[model samples]
Target chain A: MGAEVKQTILNRLIGGIDAMSPRLRLAAKYIVDNQSAFGIDPIRTSADKAGVSANTFVRLADRLGFDGFDDLREPFRVSLLERYDGSAGEAWLDDLSHAGAFAADHARTLRNEMDIVKQSLRLLTPHKAEAAAALLTEARNAYVTATRSSYALAYYFHYVARMSLPHVHLIPRHMGSPVDEMVSVEPSDVLMAITFPPYSADTIDALRLARRSGMKVILLSDSELIAPAIQADLFLKVSVQSHHSFSCYAGAMAVLDSLLHHIVTRGGKAAELRISRYQSLREDFGAYWRAKLPRLRRE
Target chain B: MGAEVKQTILNRLIGGIDAMSPRLRLAAKYIVDNQSAFGIDPIRTSADKAGVSANTFVRLADRLGFDGFDDLREPFRVSLLERYDGSAGEAWLDDLSHAGAFAADHARTLRNEMDIVKQSLRLLTPHKAEAAAALLTEARNAYVTATRSSYALAYYFHYVARMSLPHVHLIPRHMGSPVDEMVSVEPSDVLMAITFPPYSADTIDALRLARRSGMKVILLSDSELIAPAIQADLFLKVSVQSHHSFSCYAGAMAVLDSLLHHIVTRGGKAAELRISRYQSLREDFGAYWRAKLPRLRRE
Candidate 1:
């Protein structure tokens, strides 16, 4: 399939959404709403969930000028293969519907996270980590950006990083537009963007603005094939696949922690002094509560 | 050992902190600063990191009226045993310090997280999960409280829960004191408290206040031996031990996810409508980015 053909199909789907029959509209809505799932789910299952017949799915595809439903699904499948590692976790979700299957689901989710962590470690070579750490250490200022599902990871990273490094900012400045925050980014600074599919557009827009300003961009995403990869100065992939509707972030958190650790350990006396100061201040502010141990007899 | 002796030792340590010699002060500071490590690390290693002689630790213990360093460390060890599962990850840290050991460390951390997840699954019985879900579903209002490292988990939980259910509040209003927020909580409400050691004093205080208000208290903690556990109307323990300095949250996140899933799936039509409404609003707001697939030839 050529780019033109894919674009044509997508345009037709978008343009013709209003004119389709109710059944075709249901199928179309499912396709548009769950593009990722459409890529991986079987046609029959997709039809069943969308409450449409498989024949309707085929008819819709034919209406859209595809040879068959497979043609319609081909772009999605290819995208999935290029952009994600491992299966789509539909089977894991199936297990979750069974009675007393929560334990099994939990186990599978953890196992999946472990596998992702291992894969991330394998993919993030020491050389690349060292390079990324050096960029963070050398940058005059750094900004971190993530949105939606990834916001927690960004918040944690920024909270921890700001403790040991000066001038580390989490964009788009709480109350201001993210674009406004990206406006001041300079070549001497770095923007560490954390995003995964469905990737946050705000983060991508920030990345674009930062890149245009000549700021170094460090992209932490689920796959290198993501659109933002082309703009990144350094790209690190960490898997976030989960059995549930939301993406798992355990692997992403681990990667971010490892990156922060690398920067701190690789940084010399300056880093040590900063961390020690942060620790002292934390203690003084009573950020950590002392455990009130119940008295026990000495042996 | 009886409780009185342990209290005596701890009291002595706190009382004598101001008058100790410089070397003893160093050991004392290490003990105070890293109580968890003091509980788990060997004297030699702890002293080495504290930049003091092992003799200083013994001397400090003696000054505190202990038989030796072992007596000084005993309470911490006991507390560790009662409150946490698995080793304190000394070996994992050792592996981290070695050159080219990042992969090994990553694998170990993931493995440890997997074990914790499994242990948590075993501990959190289906009956308890169902009961917790029912409480959440039936509550007139629900509030979540957590502090410091555990704050992210609380935020995620509250964020997701509020989407599917009404009247879910994250405790300790962002800009105001947590006490201010707790004032509005009524007996009919539910307070879900997430905490781990060293336990946050603020969260514990909130829990106490909520209990006094006659609200149902649901405690999610690393261990049932924690002080707040006694006051809890419902207690759920999930291990957060990891191979790194910070606690692994994969297990905690899993438990929270499971709880939410239970509430949603069992909530019937009201829940389904809420979720569907949420999904539609998310799309309307462009909360999810569309996938930009590059065209690929059909095989």
Candidate 2:
């Protein structure tokens, strides 16, 4: 679900808890009201503060699909962490139940992320994916431009795609007439533009110009409501969740990685031979990387 | 093994094959003598021209540790495709038996890339990664400056890192005296410079100026040989394999991805909180990527 939808669900749940059994509803209210203290305070301490029985809290969790109160505390702890720095995490541990609750919530979030990934894959038409692959494979020249958080996504894709194609260029930032350059983009070439919420004006301008030149365009964005659809040959709408305060990309990165794998797989025999030749050159350079071995340091 | 080791092994294998039985040796000689042309002609056609039996050609593949003749032909096909584009593949289909050999060779290249990634991970000291992370994380302002191909790499890193840590800037190309700006850089701020082989003289000049100001410096490069290490508080060297005539980023992207993962993991609660707040605002403003997803087709 998009961020707006998810937040709306939470808001409704909070509003409707009064319709439940008296004790269960009371526990739910306490949980919601004291969420900011979840990780910092033990459930027993929270129970004491909320004036609710521990069993009632556990029962409320069960009603919410959690095994016990610990599950309910997870989201609360995450919220606390999202609101404060790590230093505040210690303050949250005033009781041990907070950690267990937080872990359970995190586990659930990961499961939701997996579901999103599957849904995303399903929503992507096979023809669109194949078209993207063809564009990447056939481009004599590929230009990738992105700004803000999405720029890394474009840069990573550009770097990998450049290996098998010719004349791949990464457009420079603030360079004169990025759009003018796009106006000359060849018919067979592709311009990949990646942007998320609060899209950079420059990236949008470039995509508009590239499309006007009759070049193919691909977009990776957060919502269909605000995305640039006119220039997009293929558009992928992704909903990202934050672990703390910024939008998450674990899902986006996974999808991008799969796309790269698919491109290489379909490149046929020519790609294989080029890779073989590269292996020879790598050995020739001694490639200073040999000095470091596994289990040495974390990069 | 790097490109050098791969080349050495190839040479050794070819030499050993040349010294074997007369028929085997002749087959090897024909292949070695016409390495470049193998992709241009089918195996049967080439074998007939060499006066060697088709079965003898199959044995040559087996002697080279290939499953069959098709396996052996794959490499040639790949080479031609990468070097000559798709036109060459059209001319090279006569050798149906060489496919199997080439696929295995290609798989080996990915394995080499994995090795490079492993080595890069090991070489990147946790101390440096943390120091670099902390420098950028704590900076009141950060500037990313790079030229040529390295420029995209620098911008990508800056874009992602800037999400949680705001106040980061991407210097517009040729904006003049990036050094002058760095001269005013305080101890709490940082300047990141990226340059790879055939390193740009201008990039070096800027790094030297930045270093003199006692501002934190981070350097990303492909080879330490070409990248000066003196001015950097942290240095990361990544190796990229060449495919066709272009350098591949299997290693560089992997290292960069890993860095982002590590930094976010270490950022703990602060990152999550920042992300949450950012997401909230992102939904409200949608500034990151609004224009890339065009809604209507343009003529």
| DockQ, all models | 0.03, 0.05
Error of 2 at B195 (Å): 2.3
Query: A-chain TM-score in candidate 1?
Result: 0.60
User: What are the runs in model 1 whose C-alpha is more than 4 Å off?
Assistant: A1-128, A225-230, A267-299, B1-125, B223-230, B242-246, B268-273, B284-299
Which pairs in model 1 have colliding backbones? A1-B297, A1-B298, A295-B3, A296-B2, A296-B3, A297-B1, A297-B2
lDDT values, one for every candidate: 0.66, 0.54
- lDDT by residue (A19-80, candidate 1, tens digit) is 77767766775675455456656688787766677888899989987899889887765544
Quote each prediction's TM-score. Answer: 0.59, 0.44
> Backbone clashes in each candidate structure, one number apiece?
7, 59
Tell me each candidate's RMSD, in Å, in order.
25.7, 24.9
Tens digit per residue, CA lDDT, model 2, B1-299 = 12222233246558797468887777777766665444345677778877887888788778777898866766654433222111122112212213455433333333333334433433444445556666666777777877544565666666666665676766544446456456566666677776654456556666776677667877766643232234367777655433333344434544454455445655677876776666556445444332344422112
Tell me the tens digit of each residue's lDDT in model 1 across B210-284.
878999989898744343223578889776764333456656766776677667666667876886676556544
For candidate 2 chain A, the 10 contiguous residues with the lowest summed lDDT are A290-299
lDDT of 1 at B257: 65
lDDT of 1 at A219: 92
